[model samples]
Target: MGIIKKIFNKSRSPEDGIFFEEMRKILGFNPVDLSHYRKGFTHRSSNKTDENGNPINYERLEFLGDAMLGSVIAAHLFKEVPTGDEGYLTKMRSKIVSREHLNELGRDLNLIKWVESKVSAQHFGENIHGNLFEAFVGAIYLDRGFTYCEKFINKKVIVPYVDIPKLEGKVISYKSLVIEWCQKEKKQFHYDVFEDNGNEDVKHFGVRLKIDGKIVAKARATSKKKAEEKASQRAYFAFQEKINKK
Candidate 1:
């Protein structure tokens, strides 16, 4: 009876001890308390309430993760690129933490598998991975604190990829660059975005790039920004030789 009672007692812990252990393996750190990590992966769709009857989800965790990511990335860039000015360092950090890169990282790690949600995962957009990644960072901050968070960022983000020269060439937004050039050259520019009746599961926007009252390029994409950027990029390339000649 004593042994049986002990086994029952072990089974009644508020913490999912086994799950926590597995999570430690996954995160490469023994979480001091499981609640932080648990809340990190908790999707809003579950509509869960905490002990205080307040909503519980990964949103707050995401905020923390974003800040952690930026801090660590900034530190790394500052030390590595001593010659880089403020704008250069900021742009490099932005490239590393950009939504596209974060999404790719989260997807690579299959981070969403642990998310507790009432909604189907398939229904979620690509941005979910990036959000989950940020939430995970927040959880790490709450669980093990900043030192561990810095280590994780260094191991996962900086050491493997961060090529300063290559990052400098990476285009975060071609549309912004083209627009700036147009403005500088005193050329009128407009991105005429309109809905496209296309044969596809998702709705798409079509963008026409006009410069000095002439159509330079046209592109279509699932989002207005994407379409405009595509058109702008194309226009930039098409007129690159001529534009640089001036």
Candidate 2:
């Protein structure tokens, strides 16, 4: 048996779960309530519920985590960039808390292995990483409260991942930038997005960018935001010369 096989072949025992061990190692502390972490990793497809029959999954935790992450990032940015105005600080916070970066962080930590889900990993979309990361953050907040949450962010996120200069140049939403530029340039633009139900297992959306009533670009992605961004990118390239001239 090879290393990969050996790793996967480990018995998933109830008493000594390898995943829980890994979680403890990653978290640097033993979890007070394993159920919190369990729910943190759970996907809504599992159809789980608490004693009161309320849905018990990471979605609610993800919501909580998102707010916490934002608060932490905002606090850090505020102190780090004391001279930064609201727009600058807001942009920095956005860059730090962006879904793409959060997804990268979560994936690097391999948070998916703990998830309890009926769906296959192959079936899940990329956003799962970021969402799961946020869910885990929420779990930490609930389990350990604000102090530990702040410590974790500082140690795991701020110390390693955040750099002021790099964050300043980071683009959280290229689509937003393109739209802003279009509006400022007095150019007429429209995005026509429609659901595309094709042979793929997941539903997708197709987007076309119309500039001055002419089709400038088109794109398709798993979600509307993705499709819009892709269309915006294509539109940006198509109108690059014209937009840059102004």
The numbered model that scores best in lDDT is 1
Q: List the residue pairs that clash in candidate 2.
A: none
Residue-level lDDT for 127 in candidate 1: 97
User: For model 1, how does the per-residue alpha-carbon lDDT over 106-146 read when each residue is reduced to its tens digit?
Assistant: 77556787889999999889999999999988989987789
Error of 1 at 113 (Å): 0.7
Cα-based RMSD of the predictions, in order?
12.2, 11.3
Candidates' C-alpha lDDT: 0.82, 0.80
Report the lDDT tens digits of candidate 2 across residue range 65-156. 99888899889888888899999988888888888999977875678877889999999899999999999999999977887788888877
Q: Which stretches of candidate 2 lie over 4 Å from their true place?
A: 1-20, 170-246
Query: What is the Cα-based lDDT of residue 240 in candidate 1?
Result: 78
